[model samples]
Target: MSAREPSYFAKCACGKFCAELYGEPFLMGGANCYCNDCVAACYYCDDKARKEGKTNISMRCADYQGAGAAISCWLLDNLRITSGKDQLRGFKMSAKSPLCRTYTACCCTPMIYIGQKFAPRWRAFNLNCVTRASDGQPLKPTEMSNVMGDFALKEAWDQIPAGQPKYKMIPWGLFPKVLAVIFLPFLFPGSTVKVLEEDRAVPGMFIDAAMVTEVVSAETYVAAGVRVPKALLEDKKGK
Candidate 1:
């Protein structure tokens, strides 16, 4: 089957610049990020550039699809540059990183990073330079790793719903097993098959309605530094 397509539009702060997206809206699942590089880039370079008399710190680009020739043509022809080409600057990181090819010249803003990498047959319009209102909300990461571990927080993942049309969804019931099978190897040091098997047997017992009372009691007991079962608690409280 052909891969899914996602697209988005971005604009600069001035409202004078805008770009269109034509490919998969997200490059990776849940904002896959390389923490060391991204953190250094954002804090030392991007943040510094902004502090140095940079009013329009935002950069914007649109994701698109189609052949490379067509995509390049579209970007050059259609991308409306509303302001400060002189301020633009492109920075290159690893020669292997996809940004190497895309971040050719930082003519408009030095801090703004733009580059292309082989991604699910899609493109990412770096959002750092977006200055227009139409640039849409900040680019929510599709996958995030390391950093503040904010991405690991359950609340962060809650923003997206299950079974959204644009993306595939894993059933909540299957999540633990799926995660164990897929990620446990990388997360844990040893063989994951056994761990995954064990995990699958438990299979999110905390969320099971049948175990809610027990789970709640365990939580309360733990909070109180006591060991009491829900049944015992109920009995003692005459509930």
Candidate 2:
């Protein structure tokens, strides 16, 4: 299942940066994560944009904050920075944190997140930044709850859809599911399946997360006007 053309197109708010995204969304495993990091990152991007006087870069920042989760598509092994890769910048929550969030330097549009969990193999694109589908229709792929219900802000937690399952952390079963998605093509090679090709992956950004100056932390989120969840605050205090 190789797509000669891009299935989705993602661009920064500034329109200076763009990427061609390929892969089936369902096969990629989309999810909504309610973890503190995910929530804080959204607030951080919004705050950064405001400070720089960059307008119209919202990309659902408030909506994600209000909904208490960040939805992402686990785009594994098929990404191409079509233009403005030089403007790509990223940051980590801390020196030790495995998560690295990349954004466009021009307008601070939060783009992709690659954590140690995904590592050299996968990248999760923020659903907000993915603005267009090749089909010219709205992009709506089914998603499952991924993690951290306890860290959602009170109001945000209340906004979760009824009957949607919430987890305090990533469920153990998630590992197997992820593994299956990654290896299925190799297990049964056929026209119906597609194995990820490193050669077609993102060529490389202007800078890796290591070079990004700012480090996000609890204090940083607070300074950015993000309301930390009471449960998260309590958990940190306990530690």
Evaluated with TM-score, which candidate comes out highest?
2
Alpha-carbon runs more than 4 Å astray in model 2: 1-3, 26-29, 59-66, 144-146, 170-173, 180-211, 223-239
TM-score per model over all chains: 0.33, 0.71
- Residue-level lDDT of model 2, residues 18-135, one tens digit each, is 7777766533245566556676776677778888888534434246444433445544456666787667666766554545676678898777765433443456666666644656
- Residues 1-239, model 1: lDDT tens digits: 97322244444344343445444333232222222233223323323445554444322111111001101111222233333333233333332233421221222222323322222122334445322234455545454222122312233223333553121232244346544544545677574222223222221111112221211222333332223334544655674
> What are the lDDT figures for the candidates, one per model?
0.31, 0.59
Question: lDDT value for candidate 2?
Answer: 0.59
